[model samples]
Target chain A: MVTYVAIGLLAILASIKAFHYYYQIKRAPSQKQLSKLVLSTLRRGQSDRE
Target chain B: MIKKIAVTLKPYNRVPFVYQKLKICRNCRHFTVLGERDCMSCGKTGGLQPVEKRAAGIVRRDQWLTGLILLLLIVIGLLFSASALQTVLLIAAGAAAAALLWTLSKRFTPALRRIQLQKMFQQYSYELASGLAIDHQAAIRVFQEGDKPRTYEMLREIGSLVHNDQLKLEQIMLLQTFQLRKDMDLMLEPLLMDSFSPDLVAYIGEMAKIRRDLIKENTFRYMLQHEMYILNMPNGETVLAAVAGAAVRKSRYMTMYPYLLIRYARLLPKDRFLRLYKFAKSARSGPLYDEVMRIYEEKFKWDPDFQNA
Candidate 1:
């Protein structure tokens, strides 16, 4: 009975972790996207300054 | 045009006298001040301009809230480790918390960056307005230096920005630096000399006392300067009470209690001091309050009749 309970808990924890990772991947921009946005913003600001 | 020229020339005639009083950049390593259209030392051709002070980035309310939630989840997870079910629940909570934080950061990073840049510009303007002659480069250098003595120097320059009037931003910056480095002597020196809103002056005095830098006599004198101003205001009294409580808890500046209490006694309602005295008497005696009460008795000599009556 204890072994079955432990397995269930492990499965639940793993599922939760997987779900969270998937959600983050969907919600957050990749590092490349973030860097590109930052660089473009910097260029725009510099042009405006000039 | 003749009147304008005469008016302009008038300043030159007075320049010798004023120049004697003015700080020259030649001796100052941080000096960026120069004549019209050229830096005298560097020969960089531009009008002699004062340096701008920039503000640090502003942390928005949402960012703080998200950060707090993430911290709470992590703490809860650590605390629930004894129970397997609870631990598992907490681990899930932690994963959810991280995901939320990541989402918020991605959405808000640009806005946060803009707020930060604006703050830097504002700080730069404040420094220039204060006569610090700080440019962006100098400001960056000052921030990068980041040693106690260097921080103190930066604070001193910033404090100069607060003269006869209370400049809130300048005062906040100075206080922020002083909070990091408890240099009571440096912090109190300007407060002692300058005229400020009674609440701010009192707040600074309380801080000075917390650091055990204010002797009873000096604290009494400071209180006397704005006694009526402080006594009439509720906010001033509240700030004083908070500082006193904090000092008692910290116990590092125990010697400053007498002066602080004296100021409190004079400004606060009789009932307020009475309650405070009761709290102090019942609370575990520390070096701070012991010295405070000792000084209060020695200086004022209330006798046995006024013992928490």
Candidate 2:
């Protein structure tokens, strides 16, 4: 009886974890913006060196 | 004469997209939060521009990567489970749990972004301090892109390390563009001058007017010691009035501004004179106060209520 209860609790926890990732990817801005951010940082670094 | 460097610099080159989502309507001047296509107030679409970032933040990559890896691990764990109805149900539950963890972790995104921006700023500050020259353009870009308080903090950091007058003048020029806080003014107190370039003096004068609370007593003393030549520029009187007002509020030593007050006593505006009058009246009666009072009386005819007392 105890073992069955433990298994049920574990299952519930895993479901919660998977749903969290889905939300993050959904909320994230487009890949293009992310790439732009990276490019700008690189450009700034180069300019600072010069 | 401090000449303006004519560099055709793009103001928004280093600004990120997330920072540009908000705009002010040109037609109505209403602040629009989300819709960029049309002004929510007047429906004028063309005049919208990115004005300011509402929050200090950056995209937190590490947390995102961690959540992804955790989800991937859960998927692999479920794939190895046996093919029974109970096993399938357990796998479904596992997926759900992983999803919750991932999404809940994202709630930390804003907090993480703040921390990351701070860390990045600190690193950059150290770099600027150790370098041979002050990077005015880089500082301007940071001021434009970073959070308001942090930008001032970075300025303070750079300001402390900078010793050259030309660089100091540049820093002051950069500083004037922002709406500065009192604490930032305090940080810039060490840069106060008995004499400076007319342009720099004008800039400092503007700062004194806008952020009066930030000026230290020593700055007032510096002003008192310097000859009146510093105030001969276009906005010199405005600067003097600002300094006098700030000195009245900040100077604890009673004897400090007496000479200045006496010299410029009659020239002071009614409000400023009243402020000085009130401060002098409240202070302990000493020879210095008496002398100051004598000077005030010399400038303006007034009968004191406390003369009989």
Candidate 3:
């Protein structure tokens, strides 16, 4: 019974990870997001020097 | 005649986003935008991979882990199966789930990679910023060592990420030392400043004379806003005329910046005036049309080229 229960839990966790992966793929970043990444990181670099 | 120093400058590697040039150490995960070999932080050789490749590697690892979990569950279920029927059912279910996941990942590979890249950047923003800062310091140290050309090259690489007025000005000041040659790789748009500086205007004028094609709307606009200060310079009219000549290269410029021609039409060299004359002949009567026509009459009335035009 304990072995069966562990199998069930692992199966459920795998499905959950798959679901998260699907959403991550679906909501992939746009051009604006990449541009923001560039601006934000550059801004951080400037502040760091000061 | 003005002399120009000729030097071969390596063309900059172009990218849609500057971050694309970054390489991260797979070992220490330290990021750097410099050369793609050897982790500068850990001194480990051959441990660096391009950021996108690193992101894709992470995606593949996650995918493998998920698949392995499903496989492990099926094996555990089969080991404790009460009947042959239970064993078959567990195998079929696990196989189906693995197939579905493999197909999904294969189809969404590009999207998965892009999403992973965004995540990687967010998670490692601090490391990436520090890496770039270190690159900047290294460049400054080179400058201190009095290798002006080498220092400029280093700054140019770092400028891909660290774009601010100070960096732009430093490049301009260094450029002022070297005689700018038309054949050398020079960039104007990246170095354009938000505010006015005499050094910048002089550079613009220099570019206008040699690389007229680099003179675009931003440059025209810059010159227009600071026309008074430019006029105060001994050769200001000459600079303005050279810029006007660049405008004549495109009909779009003639239509877009008539005011520029109106003010400096007479100062334009003969060839530029001929082009403006041809444009003026087609005008339906804006201030630009009138100015070009008046200049044509006043300056080129008896010239053979004007008569043919």
Candidate 4:
């Protein structure tokens, strides 16, 4: 019974880690996308001035 | 006889200015301008120079005293360790003595010296920030005469008072003196975040946006959010309304707006993007207004529902 309980806990921990990695992957691109948007805005500004 | 008289008169004329300059030094509570080389007042040789008061001598003396006290405590601790009770008592006494010495140094010497040093630096920084040429000798005196902490505090205070673009531009030239960009950013952060003063915020935002630092993205995001919030609110003052209306009309957030609009449009079945589009269309035309309209038309080609209206 104790062994079974330990196995369950390990499974839960593994799932949590997997979920965390997925969340990080999802959030990382949003920050990059925001930066890209700002860069593009700056480029557009330069082009307009020219 | 005339040449001799002229020389004597010249010497007499210069004596008043010299005396006037040294009057404060002579009357200083710490002054000891005895005939001997050493100053009897502060116990240092040649310490009473014909200049303004400085704290460098006090700093050196305090450092020496702290070091000596620490050495004495270490020796005392080593001698008393054979008896555990005596060792404990000796340790406690040493700690108390150190604390007392620290308090005395803080209250009597370094604290007062730091206040004087900070005042001197503040005056120098204010003059520099105001676009006036700083006296290099006075600046060097401040740097050489004050402790590091006192100098840093004075710089921070002076930097915080800088509100004009010219002053900010001048102050930013001194960024090299600070260890981290965040220290300078902290001094600028409040001015940038001021909600009621859009022009100040815009100026700070422009400066931050130009810098290839983390502050650029952070400040832009803050400005964008602030503009959006001001626009969404119904009852805003003229300045807030003008800034928001200008920002929206100009489409300052054009690149990011489509992504946000698409998401918001998806959440609202009534199509909120159309409302924003109409609002932008009706808003007065400016440089930003034209840009905003171009982005909306290019990104979202929603059929005009007003054709039947």
Best by lDDT: 3
lDDT of 4 at B25: 21
Q: Which is the better candidate, 2 or 3, if ranked by DockQ?
A: 3
Chain A fold similarity by TM-score, each prediction:
0.56, 0.52, 0.60, 0.54
Candidate 1 fnat reads 0.00
Candidate 1 residue lDDT tens string, B1-309 = 111111111111112111111121222212322222344444444433322111112345545665574565456455645667766665665566566556656665654444443333333332222233343234436556754344334434433332323333344443443432343333443445334365455546456445534333444455546656765776666656544444333333334454565444434434444445555565548643464366447543574534535
Candidate 2, B-chain TM: 0.45
How does chain B of model 1 score on TM-score? 0.31
**Residues A2-21, model 4: lDDT tens digits:** 33333333344334434543
Winner by lDDT between candidate 4 and candidate 2: 2
Interface RMSD of each: 14.1, 9.6, 2.9, 23.8
Output DockQ, candidate 3.
0.47
Docking class of 3: acceptable
Q: List DockQ, one per candidate, in order.
A: 0.03, 0.10, 0.47, 0.01
- Model 4 misses residue B5 by how many Å? 56
- Name the regions of candidate 3 deviating beyond 4 angstroms: A1-14, B1-4
For candidate 2, the per-residue lDDT at B240 reads 67
Score each candidate by Cα lDDT: 0.43, 0.50, 0.80, 0.38
Give lDDT: candidate 2, residue B244. 64
Writing each residue's lDDT as its tens digit, candidate 2 over B1-309 gives 443332322122222443233344446544332334565456565755433322231244455555565555455555654556545565565566556655666674554444443343234433322221323444556667844444444444434434345446655665555554444333346466545556556665766666766566766666655547666676676676666666666446335666655555555665666666767777757554575577566765554533422
Candidates 2 and 4 compared: the better one by TM-score is: 2
